[model samples]
Target: MAYCYTASIFFPSSSSSSSILANDRLPHLAYRPAKIKRRLSFSCAALPFDLSPPPIDHDLLDTMTVAGAKVSEDGVIGTFDNDDEALDAVENGVAVVDLSHYGRIRVSGEDRVQFLHNQSTANFEILHEGQGCDTVFVTPTARTIDIAHAWIMKTAITLVVSPVTRERIIDMLKKYIFFADKVEIQDITQQTSLFVLIGPKSDQIMEALGLADIVEQPYGSHKHYSVNGMPITVGVGNLISEEGYSLLMSPAAAESVWKVLLGHGAIPMGSNAWETLRILQGRPAPDKELTDEYNVLEANLWNAVSLNKGCYKGQETISRLVTYDGIKQRLWGIRVSSPVEPGSTISVNGKKVGKVTSFTTGKRASQPLGLGYIKRKAASEGDSVIIGDDVEGTVVEVPFLARQIPPS
Candidate 1:
């Protein structure tokens, strides 16, 4: 097994032989200096406008009841009586959420399709109107730069990546466009708006907004429709257990749209609430649970990787890794009693096997749960491990239960 070092660095090209070393007295894992420029800080102002007051020292929210717990810190928002109830809220009830932490980029120009096809893991050229896909952009050496979801719009290509990879993705794209045709990259994270709706009742909210005749489709399916007689675009994603849909609109239309949904009975959930939902479902978010160091297979990103799709960057490594069973680690979920923190080591039989990436507590006083990367041999559900120093945790199967998706 590779030894843990302190420095965090990007492995740009497969052939490049530079290795990072860390000398700090912290965790003994290898570290590579993060490449992002710290131009924006959490203390800095939120772009466009700041809706809430300045963040308090303890900004975490709690949603608990007398019978059960809400969500815990580290971003778990609410607590439902059971898994089915939580899924029901997503499928049939309104689940208003704030995904502002997600990074957004805009690609425009005649060559946008070709440009993205060359840079992303998925076949961008195959994407038609109203459809979007999950893809990863990696360095020549196959280290991940960003995991992004891309959509084709009338005038531009919109990409949503993690905050950590936003700048690196932009820079990488720029370097690749050296001899390419017309293409412009712009950060439009704040200029545009995004929201998610999942459930049988979701249609009611869309219909309330005047989004008529919206045809139902499966995950990875999408189409253009009008809401409230206003032109809006929709994308289908991550609906393994319900009718799921993601909504995109101009910033100007966001407030009005939010009000309409609330009036239609949608529950305005914070970021933590949505994240807990995602984690419980085995979904991986950029940087938080996935990064450049992981291959698509290791990250359980099969939904996004199309085997039949033609060649793209890093396809060779993916194919080789899959064919040879070369995946070294797997991202899986675990339930722990102790508070788990990201970057902590996960051990089995007293040997280092994996590391924790994301962890959260119960809404009020429930047990702690976390998502971590583990050696494939150590990944079975019900397996046990220790987190941080003394926190005890157990591995659990994803989705935490059976998932049901709506009809196409």
Candidate 2:
């Protein structure tokens, strides 16, 4: 059993540590935190960005959208036309999403692997050439610095990181350098174009785009190819779904790649569809859900946090939580009758127990689907919750009915 101190801190009642979820029992929770606590109110999404607008035609995107949501601070579209159109694109047609917001960092030098190995949760020492791994860089207290994907190229490691946490990630990674290490970090986000492709036909479409050799490669693995005499980097596996790849190419080649993908049955999807599917798969955007307010375990980032890995920035705190107090709450799926917004309060039997981190209406279903952290005692498979205005939501399994990929 554990007692909630403030929203983010917990103290265990017993010295014997129990596995997070075991013996068909809920972890005992006591002394819930009050709503007056301000620690949980910090939002990374509320921060400012000075990003240049993407090269895509904003006028055309604005005209196409009936309703819109921006994945970034700039005028990026979350959905073009409507959620239904984007949903149809994902399920039936190939969907292409502009991910210019995702930041890219190149870590190079002789000590690059060892340098990253000391900072992230994954074991980068074993990350071979052309291989990749999903990892997290965390604070000394184990709060998420960023959830990132490291693609180990022949001479350097490319870290594709969350948009909202981009600057912080780069700064911290650079700040932690010792004079002895030989790593050099470079931000290449502006020089490169990132596009995510999703659907059952995504692989086939990728093949048609001169990425056939890398289409079936696993997540984090990338291959450099020349398309139209321009260098392109193809990464297989979509972070949002079972089928897809992240295509990275120079800005000069973006238009050509976009046209090729669109011509080969890739439907343009805006931030709305991309976000809806992301929430459906229980993946939280750092801006919407990740902040110092939450830890990796509570964020449902089990895939990114490597408990067995050697010491890293936050290893001490992570090990302590996993072994002792455990997580008091965890991100869970919620189904509501109406659309619920992020920052929405979640109560169990009229007690404020959680907060909505990410939310959206089902594309075709048009009912509400969301992800939020619920107290351990309140987070059972069929538990129910009350959101704003008496709307009721049931705790459902994450991924809300979608194809699942192998955990990273």
Candidate 3:
């Protein structure tokens, strides 16, 4: 059975003076529609075998036809209300987006910490309750496989992963289990909703929603609290450089949570908006920046790994690379003269030296910024690289935030 309601209500007219609350007196969680609501017949039950329904009200989203780009089978919005507004919200104001489309696994048992510590780039042994850290999973050859956020909680350590590598990571974890190490993996993505709030105003938005203030929390630390009568985990951290927060809640409460955030001035964004921000921030994404083609060293994820930590899978090669400075190509930012396609050849004079990985325009900087891997020999800070015929690009510092660094 599919639930539906009038499209107008979902994107209520800005001028309409009528309140959506039950009576303007009901608590946010207790409010029920005083008027009878209709549920139209529209089935969205069947989806691609490899995909899951986006943990959102597709019926309501479909009615929001004015904004957003293509709708994925999982109902992911490629863009919502134009990239410009989304960019503005994330760069200058508060923005919210559902990341339930990503993959997550719950790992438990006595050996959870040791098991993870052996497999990832980060030292998980130090993780205590309410702490989290960014880590990378590499193959025996030290090639990047996945980058995940490990959340230490009372019941389990939750590993949030990219949907592209969810199955592979699970298989790897299952394959390496020694049978007595005591570890279990459970996919919790379908049952939970992960919403990201970013921009400087993110903390204020959370406060407006009556959630615990996050400005005081240290980065990567998460805390649980009740909001709208729903229990949620709020993680304090940004994608890379800017201020950001992650809200984790049960799927049953997703719609209500989304509605409350939006009502409190949190702008709704989409994947395109997210991709643009990440690329500009020099953050790597699974299957793109995080792939077998590159290693953790080449990806410049220095914070994800610790040299003092002892042996684990692929530790030798990674250690050797660090000590010997064996990295060939490194991720860098490219300032383009014009919009260029991702994966377009980046060349010097006439020879190709690198390839564009991600690109975006209409940004806060009002420049066409991109990120890609450039060979150590060819890339130089502020040196221009050739594109097709007319387009050219100059190497720029990554994390593409204002604090600049010379290209290595």
Highest TM-score: give the candidate number.
Answer: 3
Q: For every model shown, what is its TM-score relative to the native structure?
A: 0.70, 0.78, 0.80
- Which segments of candidate 2 are over 4 A away from where they belong? 1-79, 400-408
Best by lDDT: 3
> Per-residue lDDT for 295-337 in model 3, tens only?
8877777777767679988899888887787988888888887
Better of 2 and 3 by lDDT: 3
Residue 372 error, candidate 2, Å: 0.5
For residues 266-370, could you state the per-residue lDDT of candidate 2 as single tens digits? 888877677778887777667666678887766766666666768888888888887886788877889987888888999988898898888887777675788
* Model 3: lDDT of residue 173: 89
Worst ten in a row by lDDT for model 3: 19-28
The runs of at least 3 residues in candidate 1 whose Cα sits more than 4 Å from the true structure, single-residue gaps closed, are 1-88, 225-230, 238-243, 308-310, 365-367, 388-390, 400-408
lDDT of 2: 0.66
lDDT of each: 0.58, 0.66, 0.69
